[model samples]
Target: MDVFEALYTTRAMRRVKEDPIPDNIIKSMIDSAIRAPSGSNRQNWKFLVVTDKNIREKLSNIYRETWDYYINSFLNSAKDPGASSLKKQNDKDIETIRRISNSASWLAENYHKVPLLVLALSRNDPTGSSIYPAIWNLMLAARGHGIGTCLTTVMSFETEKVFEVLNIPNDKGWTLNATITAGYPLGKWGVAERKPVDDVTYLNTWGNKTNWNLEQPLWNY
Candidate 1:
């Protein structure tokens, strides 16, 4: 797929079909991932491609525990007295949040059923900027191969348990950064509406807006 096509269509796809991904495809995705640039060429990233059923179950338990808390918190906040808004708008926001939370909860409950689980790690004293770009590349690479992926971090919060389950060394300078679940998508990737470039980009100063008619053919009207 073209770079622009991948960028535009790589949504957070949580629902996937019950299908097994080929090992070669997984290897291709990871190969693309490691080619991403790292801070000072340190390449301080480690990946655990988890296919073991027992470990996936353990991770699923941790994920669901946190997902429930998150959903409940959002529901509680939406019920607060201070959350006044245009009724329709407020209702839409609440419903959207609820739907997303439901999807996350479902994924947590059935994590072990997914074709692949990837645990990404970074150095404890990371440069703080390089990891995300590399992960983004991984997501794009997966998208190109018709695989859906959800980048989640709930498992990272229970770092010690993850280390124990994965047998990661304590002195390896590693810290769990994220977990990504991948499988064949159940539906087409949807387009995410984004703010116009003019609304976000500034000319030379922070607040100065620039006007231009320049347009890219890839995103042509």
Candidate 2:
């Protein structure tokens, strides 16, 4: 797959088939991930690729619980039925969020069914600058192989439970940065919609506009 194609279409594919990803492919995903730059070149990252059904079941339960709590908290905090956040969002933004939330709900309900789960951990990187690029690289690599992936952090809410389930050393400095679900996609891949680059980008000054007027994704899959 083309690199630009991977970057453009690699949205969070939460809904995926249950077929197992090949071990070689999984290995390549990590190999590509480690090639990503790390903060201060420390390279202090570990990926725990899980394929055991029993372990996935345990992690799924924890994920479901946390996901439920997260949704409930968000809903309960909405003081007004029309407004979901402290700063009111426009209709388009709300709809986009609604779509994402629905996809997330599907993943939470079927977390155990996803073929693989990769837990990315890093030690001593407080800002997460060291690990996130590797995570993105892993996802992009999955896209290259026609595999779907969703990077989620909801499991971080139950850090100790996850560590116990995975037998991760608690005394060690390892922090659970993200949990990425991987499998063959059940849906078609397409370019993700976003605000135009011209709207977001600025020139040398903070408020000075670039006027590039890039209204669509540069690449189409």
Candidate 3:
């Protein structure tokens, strides 16, 4: 797929089939990921691919606990129903929270069934700037390969436990930046609606409107 097509079509895929992803495919995705620019070319990224059934089951349990805590927090916040505006805002937030909680719960229950679990780790003292760009590249690359990936930080909530369980070395400074659960997708993917660029971009000064028109194609035909 073209860059634009991949950018537009890639979405967070939480649900995937149980089929295993080939090691060659996983390698290709990682190859694309490492090409992403990093701070001072430090290239301090490590990936841990977990396929062991026992470890997956243990992580799933932790994920479920974290998801439950998130749901309880959302419910507690929505319990206070006072003014109309307050109610509307809270209701919207509650709805989004509920959807995320449900999706996470599904993953928690079924993570063991996924083909691969990838943990992207960073150095103990990374530049703190280039990390996310590298992650974005990985997700986009996975999308291009017809593989679905979800960038989750749920495992970070139980980092110490994860480290202990996985036997990750402490001195390695192996902090989990993101966890990607990957497999073949069960359905189609599409672009999510975004705010108009005019609302966010400025030409030269803050608050000044950008003159460029995204509606028009970049190259004149």
Candidate 4:
């Protein structure tokens, strides 16, 4: 697959088919992932590719607990308890938020059935400048092979339970950064819509506009 196509179409696919991804494809994804750059050439990262049904079920329970807590906390802290950060947003933005929330909730409920869960862990990196690039590489590689992935961190809220279930040694200083859920997507892949680059980019200076007028995505395929 073209790199540009992968870049444009690799959106967070939370809902996916239960079909199993081949072991070779998963290996290729991680092989591509480790090729990504790390700080000071110290690749202190571990990718735990989890496929066991029992382990996934345990993690799913913890994930659902964290997800519900997060949502409830956000609702309680917001000015309008029912609005959920949607009080002042326009109709389009509101719809987008709602769609994302629904997808996330669905994933929380069905995490064990997603076929694969990759836990990205790193050590001795205060900022996640090392492991995240590798994770992105893995996701892009999966996209190339028609596998969809969604990177999530809600499990981080209860890392102790996660580490216990996965048998990750807590004394090793490994920080659980993110969990990527992977499977064949149930929906069609398409370019993810986002704000125009020109709208977000500045020319050397902070307030100077680039005036590039990039109103649409550069890669549409």
Candidate 5:
């Protein structure tokens, strides 16, 4: 696939068919992932691809636990009048948020049924800035292969339980950064719509907008 095509369409794909991914495709995605630059060339990251049924089942329990904790926490916080960071959500925002939440809840309930789960671990990265680029590469590579992937961090809170389940060394240095679920997509793939690049991007000065007056993407498929 063209790189730009992959970039534009590689949104978080939570819904996927329960088809098994081949080993070679998984390998290629990892290869593309490792090619991504890490902080100072110290590639202190490990990608654990979990395909075993038993392991995925155990991890799924932990994942659902953590996901429930997160959702409840968010809901509880949203109910608070003074302490919540959530703004007054419009109808559109509420719809989008609930749609995403439903899909994510579905994934948590059916995590083990999915074909592949990739756990990204990092050593000595505090800000998580060094590791996420590599994870993004894995997702983008999956997009190139016509595979769907969702990058999730809800499992990070259950890192200890995850290490116990997966037999990862429970060392002080290792931190679970993210989990990626992958399989052939059950839904159609297309370019993701988002706020225009100009809206988020700024000129040399922070408040300055580019006078480029663009509405649509310059390139057509």
Candidate 6:
């Protein structure tokens, strides 16, 4: 697959088939991930490719609880329903969120059924500036191989439980960055819609307009 194609179409593909991904393919994904740059070239990252049934089941329960807690927190903080323009925009967002939440719930319930669950860990990188690039590289590599992946941090809420379940050393230095679910996609691939680059990019300084009037993506799949 093309690099740009992978970048654009690799959305959070939570819904995936239960077929097992080949070991060679999983190895290749990690091999591609490590090539990504790290902070000061420390290269302090570890990936735990979890395929065991019992461990995955335990992790799934923790993930489900965290996901529910996250969604409930959002619900509790949501604004009151109203007929104003802001409320209308929020309603639209909420609708989309509900759809995504449904998919997330599905994943939580059947996480163990998916083929691969890769947990990324890092040491001393508080901002995760180094680890996330490599994690994204792993996802992009999976996309190149026609595998779907979803990078989720909800499991981090139960850090101690995860460590115990995975037999990870209870060292404060090593932190759980994210858990990525991987399998063949049950959904079709398509370009993800996002705000145009021109709207977000600045010419030289902060708040300085670029004056680029791009209303659509410059490239096509």
lDDT of each: 0.79, 0.91, 0.77, 0.90, 0.87, 0.88
Lowest lDDT block of 10, candidate 3: 212-221
- Per residue, candidate 5 scores C-alpha lDDT tens digits across 87-171 of 4445676567677889899998998888899999999777777888899999999998999999999999888899999888896
* lDDT (10s digit) by residue, model 1, range 1-221: 77777887887888887687888988988888898888787788888898777887877777788777766766877787675553223777887877777788779777768878888888844455667777788889899999999999877767887788779997877888888899999877866565566777899989987765333324421
Q: Write one digit per residue (lDDT tens) for candidate 3, span 1-221.
A: 88887887777787899888888888887888888888887888888888788898887777677767766665765675653554444566677767777776777778878788888888844455666777788888899889888888877878888888888887767788888888899878876445567777997899999856666433221
TM-score of every candidate relative to the true structure: 0.83, 0.94, 0.83, 0.92, 0.92, 0.91
lDDT of 4 by residue, 1-221 (tens): 88899999998999999898999999999999999999997999999999999998999999999998986665444435456555445557656766788989999999989999999999999997799899999999999999999999989979999999999999999999999999999989988888888888899899998998888888785
Better of 4 and 6 by TM-score: 4
lDDT of 3: 0.77
Q: Number of clashing residue pairs in every model?
A: 0, 0, 0, 0, 0, 0
Worst 10 residues of 1 by lDDT: 212-221
Evaluate model 6: give its lDDT.
Answer: 0.88
CA deviation > 4 Å runs, candidate 2 = 80-92
Candidate 4 local accuracy as lDDT? 0.90
Q: Select the stronger candidate by lDDT from 3 and 6.
A: 6
What TM-score does prediction 5 earn? Answer: 0.92
Candidate 6 is scored at a TM of 0.91
Off by over 4 Å in 3: 78-91, 124-127, 209-221
Model 6: how far is 68 from its true place, Å?
A: 0.9
For residue 74, give model 4's deviation from the true position in Å.
1.8
Judge candidate 5 at residue 73 and give its lDDT: 73
For model 6, residues 1-221, the per-residue Cα lDDT tens digits are 77899988998999999888999999999999999999999999999999888888888889888998988666555554544553344667777778788998899888879889999999988787799999999999999999999999988888999999988998658999899999999999988887777788997799897878877666666
Model 2 has an lDDT value of 0.91
